[model samples]
Target: AEVPVNWCPELGTVLANEEVIDGKSERGGFPVYRRPMKQWMLKITAYADRLLEDLDMLDWPDNVKEMQRNWIGKSEGAEVDFQVADMPDAAIRVYTTRPDTLFGCTYVVLAPEHPLVASLTTPDQEAAVTAYVEAAASKSDLERTETKSKTGVPTGALAVNPVSGERVPIWVADYVLGGYGTGAIMAVPGHDVRDHEFALKYHLPIVQVIAAAGDDSWDIQQEAFTETADTVVVNSESDLVSLNGMSAPDAKEKITA
Candidate 1:
């Protein structure tokens, strides 16, 4: 919500997010920089549950109702904490549906517009991260996703995996939307298409943790095989817990339990 709006220094008017296009005002074509502004904000998340429950009362079509449900975004996932490296006191929290794949996570990606971007970027990586953040600020969520290339800049910061205690690099990518999920994600490149693409582009490791039935091809370089309830878990090795050889449903239940 902090993207730069069309503002006229001469007219002394502040426009809305919809009023600006291509870094210019729609009406005047005056140059506008995507800048952040301080303003009163509403706590809309407090009403999310209520809004989602009320959708059933609307006399709309099934598709329309489903669309509204998605808009509310009532996702169920564990909010795991990842401690930022070097910044002992700082951390980033991410919500993930597949907590069972924590071992497969090779890296973590944060939306360029994520609030923690500025604080997480190290001194050596500041200039590149700043420019990337600025470019992201100017792009709309849809425009950002339109680019086919899986582009991202490392934050020069690392995060400690909660389960494995392993260190992984943190990155800023336009693919991760600031408003979706938690504005951050544990990148399991082995089972996610988007994550696989990003990892391949950056030469990051890809570890397969889910074994598909009759599908011996666990090679991530070929394609990412999304696990479902029927797939069995594998390579989930950790002192805390292990889901190897367990069905996807069983693994999720055991891990979350």
Candidate 2:
């Protein structure tokens, strides 16, 4: 949000405040130098109502509308915090549409850019973690995007599963991004895409808690099992009720409740 100012010494006069030349003086044909200056700022909030009105009349494509809807992502769910066993003061939190999958989470992943990644890494793995984080940072915004390769380094820290009281290893991975619902994520390989890839790469366990549409083949599932209306929750604890023949939204609410 910073503006640039140009000053020309040979002109003997200051250029207009809005003047922006490419490596040239606006007056007297002399070289201009960039100078930092403070100026009053205009508030864009004054046009908020006008902008909203204009958007209502604009012709936007369905894809753009879908993207906007996804961006808004106003989903109702619980934000559960799982404590890190090694780091008592720290916790890994994840927002899930199906809190019923809470017991099935076998690992926890923190985005490589997460602030806690540095401190959570053990002394022995610090060097490797640092290198991974630096490499991830150096990647261009496009290269660092979600579509890029899945790279990660184990943090040597473990998070306590809130429901099962089991300690799950914490990993710093690029597959998880800081801009998502949370910088950290509960790895449910049986039901999530990124987690499935990470689990395959690391040979981690993939437990199936939700049955797919047609087949119940967990071992042969080529991709993550998506939750749908006909999907059923299986292998859940006694306190967690089964969601057989229930809609995904209803099942999620019932399990979380």
| lDDT tens readout by residue for model 1, 1-257 | 45333354544566665766665566777755544555566777789998988888889999999998887777666887899988888888898988878888889999987889999899999999999988776665555677788789999999998777789999999878776667899999999998988888899888888877767666767788785856877888688888888887677788778
Q: Which stretches of candidate 2 lie over 4 Å from their true place?
A: 1-63, 146-148, 212-222, 238-251
My TM-score estimates for the predictions, one after another, are 0.83, 0.68
Q: Which ten residues in a row have the lowest lDDT in candidate 2?
A: 137-146
Candidate 2 shows a clash count of 0
Worst 10 residues of 1 by lDDT: 1-10
* Alpha-carbon RMSD of each model: 3.0, 9.6
Candidate 1 RMSD computed on C-alpha atoms after optimal superposition onto the true structure:
3.0
lDDT by residue for model 2 over 64-130, one digit each (tens)? 7566555444555678898988677888788776686876798988877676888788999999998
Alpha-carbon runs more than 4 Å astray in model 1: 1-18, 32-44
lDDT against the true structure, each candidate: 0.80, 0.68
